[model samples]
Target: MSQSPTLEEELERARDLSVSDLADAIESIGFECTRCGACCTGHGPEADREPHTATVFPDEVRELQAATADHAGDETGDAGDETDGAGRDEDAPADASTEWRDVARPMPYGLTDGDDGPEGETFEWALQTDACGDCVFYEETETDGETTGACSVHADRPLICETYPFSVALDGTSQPMGEAVDSVTLPARGDADEAGDAAETVRAHECEGLGRDISRADAEELAAALKERAVRELTEAVGVRDTYEPARPGPGEVVVHDSEGAKRPDGTSVDD
Candidate 1:
């Protein structure tokens, strides 16, 4: 007898859906700019330092240069200096200003050995910073040059800035605010002063494009791409999982419990 379609095939079919099939769809769909400047400001200099501290991907560095060229003025040559005028050695190869191959070390994920280990490493991540709570690339401008300010690098900003409120990790997966304790808050809307509860905002804006909320159909497309990549990884790339079993808890050893009875390693019990 013939067999039904495989799970992959079914998943593919699900992905073929349209924009309407997604639950967390964006509502008004306005260009993102709360003038909050959260993306610009970071912690301290050590937190936002260059070289070993903050490394930009070759592509992003190029984009940053292009976007801020006009604003950089006489600081043009300073851009090529990896230190970005921080006084680091200018003779380094990584500081040579390669158009695209300039990869920074201390990247997000540590390198995994090819054969005997897990899958490939995750991508590197870095935060944007400047003197204030705004990014160096961030430009604040008003309609008549009399108003307050806003981000100038909105359009060509990195994936991080473009997908604020919803944060994407080193891995490709994205998480909403409530789901994560460390997520950045979404910008406040209208006279509704206080920002919504993290979880509430996440739930409310599930499909809002500004929050990196892709439609179910879009998710399907991405899933398909991932599936293909997975197959390749299993066959060609390094496999992440290793089967060596971990030592199981011994029989009499007191196990930690969340409810009712809790006990010490020596077997003394405590009440809820």
Candidate 2:
């Protein structure tokens, strides 16, 4: 059997990818989001009851927290109350205790569901889910009996969300992270498959917009984001490999191994 690529090799491969070629492949396959919410819901037409789970970087988590807090402040200001009447600054930074949990939770892949809750060691963070198993930030609207779904934190959404349905074929990394719902395989270079020497391929995943026409500009923009995501993912993988340390937690406690190090579900660092 062939050996798996090392983290360093994967990082080099990610860095060496050609963004222009990726754009060409994307332009060839084409895409336009249909706003169906399949990517954000637990029960969209193309999805099952599994809650949406996407890897979120620590910085992305902080960005979401700040965005949420800013939105809350805006709402508070609109209510015509800038102070608690006790002369407290209503615009103060959000309390990490309350806001952080709402933004992200421990990535549940390596955890086990226990009687008390999930317990075990997991790797990375995932967007928090609502009671229905949908992403907490997912929202739906009805207009004249037509329903459409959207992300409440769309602008600040993580790179995983931005580069959905598009991933590159690289050893030691899975960008979309699952079986392709629908896909168009575009070779990274010229056709040389019969000789078993073809380059990597750009993969398109499940989405209603797969075959839709896309302008070159939009395709390039998406390509750029996809390249950025690929690099970030591999970089993070290297960090995790370098910093990993086994953790032992009692039942109902969870340990998350992220690029930074192990952490509790609350985003607090776990003492070594």
Candidate 3:
């Protein structure tokens, strides 16, 4: 099996990128989100959105939980100490201890086979989804019966969402995923005093805002965000690895670990 990249390596690769470098790289290939919400809705056995997966880091899970908790608090603040359910936040479950569970869930696949944590089961946490199988953070609004998708917590969305259709390579270069189209054309070398380096040549297909022009300011803004995301991800990943414990499963059984310890089939925690 291939080995994972070390945190130091990841950080080095991401940090080496300067704001100017990335700005120049993606300026011509600029992306303006059409907000069609195509990325947010495809998660199940559909042909167009098949094999959809949104990998959220641990801190992202915490941020989303906090967002819901804060929203819940606001909901009940007028009640004067009256709790939502058992005195927890209101946007989600009233169970203070397990409210985070309602906000995020384990990704399907191997994760679904585990016992339900509400009974004492423990498992890895992933982004929660609604009945339609879209991301929980996604909200649908209808005007004149035209439905539009919006993020309930747009400012606090996960890094991947912010860098949609674009990801940093191990080479520290930015490249757009081939799934999107409608991109801004970069300037020719003689067009500007110092034409920024050429943009990546990615296959295009769907985005409506693909051909729009983007200012240097917008590219710089994206660069700052991408840098921050890369750093934070590596930092958090390092922390997780430093404290991780290998699972010691029974001969014929698998195990799930949580902060409290190994969980029971009923969602209760027991000593490790």
RMSD of 3: 7.6
State the lDDT of candidate 2 residue by residue for 53-145, as single tens digits: 887888899999878866665666667777655333466654422366898988878789888899999888988999788889999999899
Instruction: Give per-residue CA lDDT, model 3, range 1-272, as digits (tens).
Output: 54555667656655655667666655656667767777777544555544334656555766777777667566567566655454454454435532555555543435323352322222434466666667777877888988878888788887767766555453323233245443433323342244333332222344555556778998778767766766766665555456556655443343444333443332334343
Each prediction's whole-model lDDT (CA): 0.35, 0.79, 0.55
* lDDT (C-alpha) at residue 49 in model 1: 45
Best by TM-score: 2
Clashes of 2: 0
| Candidate 2: Cα lDDT at 183 | 47
How do the predictions measure up, each by TM-score?
0.34, 0.87, 0.64
Record all residue pairs in model 1 with backbone atoms less than 3 Å apart, i.e. clashing: 24-207, 25-207, 40-134, 40-135, 41-133, 118-239, 118-240, 119-240
Error of 2 at 37 (Å): 0.5
Question: Which regions of candidate 2 are displaced past 4 Å?
Answer: 44-48, 83-98, 175-178, 181-198
Model 1: per-residue Cα lDDT over 3-94, one tens digit each: 54443433332233222322222222222344644335443476664321232333454576555543343244455544436434345454
How many residue pairs clash (N, CA or C atoms closer than 3 angstroms) in each of the candidate models, in the order given?
Answer: 8, 0, 12
Task: Tell me which residue pairs clash in candidate 2.
Answer: none
List the candidate numbers ranked by lDDT, top first: 2, 3, 1
> Number of the top candidate by lDDT?
2
